[model samples]
Target: MTMKKLERFALIAMAALGAAACASVPTYVSLDPSLPRAQLTFHKGYEGTGLFSSAVQNYALGADEYCDSAKHAALFKNVSGTESALRVTPDVRTVVWAFTTYLNSTIGAGGVLGRYDDCRNAVIFTPARNRNYDIRQASTNGDAQCSLVITDAATGAAVRNVEVRASPDCIPRTKAARGSNR
Candidate 1:
């Protein structure tokens, strides 16, 4: 396989682990009424998968820096804001998003074992107090290229001075954390 294929495999594997971690996902902090706060509504519009396959996507919110995958173990919500909105303290925050599309090994459909492709990206910005923001992302060229948008909810305008950047290279998790016991 080419280098590109390896990258995709790493990401897909990570997202798959995250999916399992979601069963006992981490808990988000409650908003402190004393501190300034803002609301975020996440939007999901991923590339559709082929028939007989499944897709999984989630986001992780980290404060004051790009999401270090090593630090974030579980991926959060996959549903859009129509279900619920995220409340956060107003500060420099990073929204890390990722998704995986996979076909399970099965008896039918020319199965030669399972295969998958995945991508991850993030947006970092400081949200205004008491404002509502809509966040969305998309990827192309087999996860090589991507973009994220943050728009003002009331006016439907893109947030000014926003930064949308592709995710950095994946860093492997520590062995002890993975239950090596070595």
Candidate 2:
């Protein structure tokens, strides 16, 4: 490739990397009192509040990327969120993924390349029961914060609480019990 073309390519690649570094990552924390299995239904998106509500648009949930054993059931309609469900196994422990989007601007040389900034914030949480869940975002010192709330489907009492923070990275947890009813 010509030197000029190569230089431009290098610059674009660097810009992409920079954007990814700022993307949000989701973390999964396993709650105690393990059950054989459970169903998980959650909504992912900005809660339509705060200063950057509009800024934080088009949030996507990548289940397969973070949820090792997560199976996409269906998508429910939310005023400003995407809903999904996953059937989890006892072997899985932590579910991890990132919430990311591109930044766009109309004022400058980057206008043609309007969408330039990569925005991703890390979110981590655990499952408490097989029921409906609500996830919302909070603005903490300009950075978007994530919160998860799970409630019992029958009684409407809170079951598991989701928190956003940095934690030791983990992969899918699986176990094989050997012993027989034979």
TM-score of every model versus the real structure: 0.60, 0.39
User: Model 2 — which ten-residue stretch has the worst lDDT?
Assistant: 50-59
lDDT of each: 0.53, 0.38
98-176: candidate 2 lDDT, tens digit per residue? 3333333233443323333323443444544454344332222233444334554566666544343354222343443
Q: Write the per-residue lDDT of candidate 1 for residues 1-182, one digit (tens) a residue.
A: 44455445545654665557454335456477677788877665455433323345555566433223323322332222222356777765554444433333223455334555556666567878899888765543245455666789999999886766544333344666546522
In model 1, where do residues sit more than 4 Å from their true spots?
1-18, 21-25, 30-35, 66-83, 93-95, 99-112, 139-145, 169-182
Clashes of each: 0, 9
Which portions of model 2 miss their true places by more than 4 Å? 1-36, 47-81, 90-92, 107-182
How many pairs of residues in model 1 come into backbone collision?
0
In TM-score terms, which candidate is top? 1
